[model samples]
Target: MDEKQIIEAVKEAKEKSKKRGFNQSLEIGINLKDVKLEGADKINTSIKLPNGRGRDIEVGVFAEGDLNMKAKKYSKHVLNKEEIEEYAKDRRKMKKFAGECYGLIAQPDLMSIIGKKWGIILGPRNKMPQIMPPNKDVKEYIKDLKNTVRVKSKKNPTIHVPVGTEDMEDQKLAENIQAVYTGIERTIPVEKIANIYCKTTMGPAVKIKW
Candidate 1:
């Protein structure tokens, strides 16, 4: 997709959208062609928006020892090994907690436990905790997570992801849309992009006619 075309579409979408009481997220929808969905569930990846997500992204951490302590400083929700086990027992609570956080991080040692217990819940949703490398700063990871948008295309020809918020500048939103488009284009080797649409949370879809 052309960046200039994306900007024009973004501006047109903004102008066409009516004012809302709350900030609406600018989202993009891409329709792909000739892509196999046999293993589409495995097509999961995170892309950091060049201009950020224009909103806060909460990250939940599952860790122990010093890493757990450090994670507490950066994240509001930090679960130790015991708490992880406890969450595993309550499927509803675990699902709710997983939904609350945009991303998850875990100490390397806790990977197996998280995988074995929480994998069933987190896996399908793509909310699995990332294994945190030892001796790394938790703040950096959290900061990056705030700007990251996860892309997953499971058994579907179309991919939809949030680019930014409506309050952001048009150029920034365009850049974010381009970033997601380019990232997905590189991810799924398809014949061609059938169509691309941009819109706010409650706005009409604006098609980029490039």
Candidate 2:
């Protein structure tokens, strides 16, 4: 969608979505056409929003020793080897923990162990932890992930991703939406996109003329 149309759509969507007791997230939905939702044809990737989603994105880091110390300093949740084992045993607790964080990053050395133990729980939900080199800076990675939104097409042809919160300016929200649209367009051809829609957490979807 053009900048003018996107701004107009965001304004209309914001107006339609009344303020709630809690801050509501603004989401963008895109429907696909002609693309077969099978195997590698599915859409699954992380896109960084230029204006962010207007919230603090909690990051969980899995590491040990010096790396663990660095990760703990920057991330809200840090899981050491022992803690990872503990979470592995308790599926319920692991699921709850995963739900609380926007994404997870792990020490590269622990990838195999994490995959073997918790892959079943996190993989299906697209919460699989990213691998980070032990020697690399943890703060930079956490900062980048804070501005990212996960977009994936699993069993459905349509995907919805949070662009920003209702509290953000209309222009900023429009820019965020455009960033998401461009990211998705990179994955799938423009002709494959059937429709695009925007909505708030509690509001009805409003179509965007792309």
Candidate 3:
């Protein structure tokens, strides 16, 4: 869904929550991978929140370069044009690529090299080389990324974040929940975002009036 729907959904959900005493604080999440990276700011920013969410998510990138440098580490098998075509036809290669990408990071420099050296090789399959900044606490964030709120709307656009939980402190939960709201707001823009609310993984949503 777009921005307006996002806000409305959140608000509706929050209202429902308050009606029921708002006792249940949910650890909400949203998927925003499909939201698109439209500019160069995300690549350069310390905190990359597509929807303008203020979260300092440090990513560990294993790409080609000085291993001790940033996270721009690399592997021998990036991809080729023919191989990309094969993967497109099979679709299984995507999974294979993902599997082989366990310790790999997408480097901006690699993308440039791929374009200059092997661009024609991987352009068609949309398998462009990418880069990620190294994470200080790679292990902790990686382990908890999926555990955060899992927002699923459409496409493979997945963004998991911690919103709230039943046991969370009121102010703390509210603060976290606001972060989620602002994050979504960043994506759709305030004008487009009509409203917002929250929903449990297996329960109804509550509207946030404030």
* TM-score of candidate 3 on Cα atoms, chains taken together: 0.39
The ten-residue window of minimal lDDT in model 1 covers 35-44
Clash pairs (backbone) in predicted model 2:
none
Each candidate's clash count:
0, 0, 41
Model 1 spans with C-alpha error above 4 angstroms? 39-42
Estimate, for each residue in 119-142, the C-alpha lDDT of model 2 and write its tens digit. Answer: 998988788888885556889889
* Full candidate order by lDDT, most accurate first: 2, 1, 3
**Superposed Cα deviation of residue 177, candidate 3 (Å):** 2.5
lDDT of each: 0.86, 0.87, 0.42
**Better candidate number, 2 or 3, judged by TM-score:** 2
Question: Cα lDDT of model 3 overall?
Answer: 0.42
Best by lDDT: 2
Question: Model 1 scores what on Cα lDDT?
Answer: 0.86
lDDT of 1 by residue, 68-123 (tens): 89888878899999999998999998999899898898888889999999999999
Models, CA RMSD each: 2.0, 1.8, 10.2
Q: Scored by Cα lDDT, where does model 2 land? A: 0.87
